[model samples]
Target: MSDPFTFQMLVNYLIIGAGLMALGTLGFLSRRNMIVMFLSAEMMLQGTALTLVAFGRYHGNWTGQIFTIVILTVAACEASIALALILILFNRKSSLDVTLWNEIREPGQPAIVEDPAEAEATEPVPGVESYPVLTPAGIEPEHQTWTVHRD
Candidate 1:
């Protein structure tokens, strides 16, 4: 059995994890692209997982490993949701830049149009609209639906 508080080894791992976390945070805060921000979030989670696993191994404890597994599950769900959002944003505006996504500023309000003429001149896409439509079954309002896996 190893001493979990071995100062030198613990300090080394902590420093490495802290550095990774700082870099991830910077990347997330400084980037406007949603994809880069999501990747940075993943990096932050990876750093956390590394720290958790290192502590688990050092202490011969299972709790940290279990926590790491929970983090992994959360990360998976986060990534899936972020990817779905990115696809939808891209489909709508043809850009993944977060700066371009200021359409909805208030709840229960239709997204603001960038140019009134553009909105009026163009024929609307079949399923795309300024507001999502509610279905009788309480499904995600139709305009908000995106095929997760379209053939």
Candidate 2:
């Protein structure tokens, strides 16, 4: 209900909002865990909402309140979807490190490892075939020896 030009009010709002933003950014950047990353993203969203509310209060406008509510709803949806995705990824890989996802390549194709050292190699038995051949439905096949060639 007043002009948005008070020095003390502005400083207070900036301090709170910017502090939240800084914490969110730090978490997002420094944390390797996917859960923490998602939480940090939500923190950023909360900081943005806080800034909006502060501006709305200072300018005596209802639009900022409406926007803040919208942001909250969007944040909820994002959290739900992100959590679901995290669960699925964890189930598949059993780890939340972004580095584990390096197998994901562009164009939706499985990434190829070039060097033998970089590849996950399996120990082979002396007289046994290394690769097993799998046939289509209702078909049985023989096993074979195969060497993977990498770039």
Q: C-alpha displacement of 66 in model 1, angstroms? A: 1.2
| Distance from true location, Cα of 17 in model 1, Å | 0.9
Residues 70-112 of candidate 1 have per-residue lDDT tens digits of 9999999998998998988788776666756655566776764
lDDT, model 2: 0.80
- Model 2 weakest lDDT span, ten residues long: 142-151
Candidate number achieving the greatest TM-score relative to the actual structure? 2
Q: lDDT for every model?
A: 0.79, 0.80
Candidate of highest lDDT: 2
lDDT of 2 by residue, 44-102 (tens): 88888888887887777798789999999999899899999998887776767655676
At residue 106, what lDDT does model 1 achieve? 67
CA shift at 87, candidate 2, in angstroms? 0.8
Clash totals for all candidate models: 0, 0
